[model samples]
Target: MGIEIIHRPLRTKNALWLPDRNLIVVKERMRSVHTRCSIAHELGHVHYGHVDDRPKHEVQADRFAAENLIDFAEIRDHLGWIGHPQLLAAELGVTHRLLRTYINVHRLAS
Candidate 1:
């Protein structure tokens, strides 16, 4: 009732909160990994009761998403044995690009 994942050509992957209906729409076409990330972001907004009036909310959502989705412990275990980014990305259920970004953002790789 709170959030619904929809597939559409959204200018940006975002959610629309309908106060009247108490519904949230999340883009479904978002990258495999980003789907979870976006879900977490929207949940953060709802959990914190963010007004979504400022662009900063997106950044905050992203931070919440990274914290929720990227399993640092699992990532470390996999990366320790697998040096290939693509392989690790596949195992982590994310794209290579997203994996690289996650790695860089978390400083998981040197």
Candidate 2:
């Protein structure tokens, strides 16, 4: 995928990396935010040297993705003002699961 993001309709449901092109292709039906997340996650794999045969590489990539997309200080400020998890998730274009996970993982809620 020469472009920033590739949409492959005939491919699998999840995003895949074309190592030959050094690109990440995701499903055609995926949301723009999800596509962005896929790109960031794949970039994390490259940035963190996750190419090695490690058992928990996927987990690390996921963590990196969340960290890259989310800002703990911003979340804390929004939570302090809004007091609604769903609204914060909606603003961030992330799932409620990830919003809650970020709060818990970063101790944002105290």
Candidate 3:
């Protein structure tokens, strides 16, 4: 909960969590939604004690971000009128990746 967040120029990454420093560094050029989602994803790594970039850890982080960022009620409202993933993501104020991760995780859980 004491993790620090800073915006810095990252050449090739959206965001990353520094375990040693309890800090989350986000790329300065990301859009608002992406910046927020990236921070949430990095916080997931902090919450889950992730120190490496394993696929499972990545998914876990993504799921954490999606669940927190996209409300299920909002997704449901969009689902009735929206059929495209991109549209749904846009309407929900999330990236397409987050929308897909939400679906995939819920699919697995159900």
Clashing residue pairs in candidate 2 (N, C-alpha, C atoms within 3 angstroms) = none
Q: Write the per-residue lDDT of candidate 3 for residues 21-64, one digit (tens) a residue.
A: 98999999789989988998988898899999899999999999
Off by more than 4 A, model 1: 1-14, 28-31, 80-89, 94-110
Model 2: per-residue lDDT, tens digit, 1-110?
A: 24355778735445755555666667787777777777666666676665542547765666677788888677756776346877887788765655665676677675
- What are the Cα lDDT values of the candidates? 0.64, 0.66, 0.87
Evaluation by lDDT, superior candidate among 2 and 3:
3
Rank the candidate models, highest lDDT first.
3, 2, 1
**Candidate that would win on TM-score:** 3
lDDT, candidate 1, 3-83, per-residue tens: 554555557645564444545666656665766655666776766677664677765655665566668888877866447
**What TM-score does prediction 1 earn?**
0.60
Off by over 4 Å in 2: 1-4, 10-12, 52-55, 80-84
Which candidate comes out best when scored by lDDT? 3
Deviation in Å, model 3, residue 45 alpha carbon: 0.4
Any idea what lDDT model 1 has? Answer: 0.64
